[model samples]
Target: MSEQHSGRRRRPHYRALSPLREHLRESFWFAPLVACVGAVLLAGLTDLIDREIFAEATAEQTADTLLSFASAAKSVVSTVSSAMLTFIGVVFSISLVSLQMAAGQMSPRVLRLYVRSRLTKATFSTCLATFVFALLVQLGYDETTDPTRAVSVPIVSTVVALALVLLSLALFVLYVQATLRLLRVPHVIDRVTRESMQVLTAYRWLAPPPGQEAAERPEDPPDGPAPQGPVLLHEGRAGVLRDVNIRRLVRVARRHGTVLHLVPRIGDFIAPGTPTVLAAGGTAPRPRRIAFALNVGVDRTMHQDLSFGFRQLVDIAIRALSPAVNDPTTAVQAVDRIHQLLAVLAPLPVGELRHRDRDGAVRLVQSVPGWEATVDLAFTEIRICGAGQPQVTRRLTAALDDLLRITPQPRLPPLLTQRRLLERAVDAAVPDEHNRAFALAPDRQGIG
Candidate 1:
């Protein structure tokens, strides 16, 4: 009973925080909002310093000099205050337009790239901060009509505002450059591929050893017969299953001496009534506790969903292949990055990973994509959309053949299956025999 009470005390804080963290990460307003608040506080501090410390200047001559400096500073701060509001408006407008263009040209999923960009957030934050700081500094200026009288001049505040404006100007230029670069297909593909690779690198350890289960021993069942415990249903608003607190779930399972099986995979959508987990071989855990161990959100993320990367790449390729676009070259570029990701994933273990407690009981079972699913995800759509385009077809052929050569023997069948499908697609789509042959031939550069 004590153990049960202690287990109940373990709140699912990770589940709650993960989604919030992801939301903040993808929001454009949060950073700039923070910057504005910080600017206000900083301006107040500067004003305090100017009044308390700088107001004590010794001589009338010194006061006159300070008054002249304050007058010039007031003009500069006023100018910055008026200009920065317009500057932020124009800069952000360009940014939004650029994002819209990129989304239309590529995939909506790529919008996260813009949202998560440090440079982008930094640019916006700095500009907004500068604007707010300038306004505060201008308001802190002395209001006395008499020009000759010694008044409190917010000298420090003015200097800080000018520095912020300069910084904002520099960031604006870099933001423009980055936004333009982001519109290019190759750069977008590369960025997605790089993020996916990082996710893959982090995920690799959970994979089973080659041709073996990721468990304590072969006898340990990765997933046993379903437990008779009550099913845990999702109670939250509908969302894409983003991630899971597997360790926490395992702890819960271990405390109850049972196995917890996740019903929805990482990328699956879970509605309010959807089955989220099954507690087997022990007493059923509380539905709320189980639900709190899962992270759900508005869209899929790279956190634990490796296939999202492939999905994004395929979206880009097929969109480029659309008749309206008719840009096979861009499709080929997307395929190039897809092939690169596959090369990295090819030899790695691919299956569900089981987590065991210290006593070797299977506490958690995580469902992951197999090799075939991954290969099909990466190649199937591209092959279908790009079948008639010689550049795309040739590149697809080269990617499959290369994977066939480098991948482990067990992984060969999937690559072979994709290769055959590509061939069939090309055969069915390309009419001329010579053109078909050219499409079928493997060329890494896609006919270059």
Candidate 2:
């Protein structure tokens, strides 16, 4: 029986693929899939070539062979085009496919713009590959059979492949143009970076201008009298990786973390050191010797803004304590409870949470809930992409800057330490007048 008659219809071809097979097929990024497809087509093509040139002995047989060859070619094209149109979505699979494509492991011929950024590029590259493959195959056939030919099948295949490839390339370019237009790359980068800059500000991360040393923080107020306001500190120079900056205002840093920003206010790189914009935590600028960094994106100064409000509430609560909550030592004692309350309400975003020791066992652990943090981190990622000119470094670097702002540091003993800081906060929060003390354990206040 002829192989066709015996009928083990060639292995279930790619086009006939079930959804799972289809997925496996497209999983390739650059497209070894194309080669695999091409190989199948090549096998089919070889079968056609044999039918045309050597499969038969008589003229009638040759005529039947030619007809079969035509049918085979049509089937190949139909199969390929169909497979190209189907898409499967499973985030992990998509990521895996993307990774493979990025590594340049797949075929370009199958790189469809509908897939991914890298895949889109691969598709464009594939168009070039198709044109070459078709032309080479046609030349090989012409050299072997030099038929002067008004209708040589090899020549026709070459022409059709070439034309299709050119068309595909054009489509690919059009898609790219549209995508670039939609994304408005330059604009989006700028908008997002600016947002990142603001985020850096919120963290009090400062990057001072080059050569201009940052003003130092004043010495801690002398230990004697009731000082007027909180000490102002000048933070140090800082820079953030462009990618970390968020387009959306969503991340929040607690305490003294710093985020940095790059300033291109002075044009070219040839001129050394553009000013680094620093975000600091103080209500207003403080003249000091120690370098302090400020976060820019946030509107509230830690000392001036957010803490002020929290402390105000603390003060109100303290005043409410009046005859009941009053203690002269309350100022030093009240802060931890208030801070714990604020910590509870922080609504912190998803972050690289850190844990550190406060005492030997009382470890300071940062908690960021999942879903809530993603929105802002994504925004930060988006913003970093848009940050412009010198574009700074990678988006992650800007993010690292942002991350640093939120990066929790260990609070060890004096430098008067976390304990003292909490105490001062409570002290500042105390009411103007301490009335007759009534009673309730200070530990119940959430300060402990």
Which segments of candidate 2 are over 4 A away from where they belong?
A: 1-119, 142-156, 159-163, 179-183, 186-349, 352-448
- Which tens-of-lDDT digit does each residue in 45-143 have in candidate 2? 644664365423234344334444544555454443443333111223443554454223212211222242444435544544453444344333322
- TM-score of every model? 0.88, 0.26
Error of 2 at 161 (Å): 1.2
Tens digits of per-residue lDDT, candidate 1, 332-430, equal: 898888889888887665555566554545687766777788888888888888888999999988888888889877668878888888888988998
Clashing pairs in 1: none
User: What CA root-mean-square deviation does each model show from the true structure?
Assistant: 5.1, 24.0
What value of lDDT does candidate 2 attain over all alpha carbons? 0.31
Model 2 residue 3 lDDT score: 13
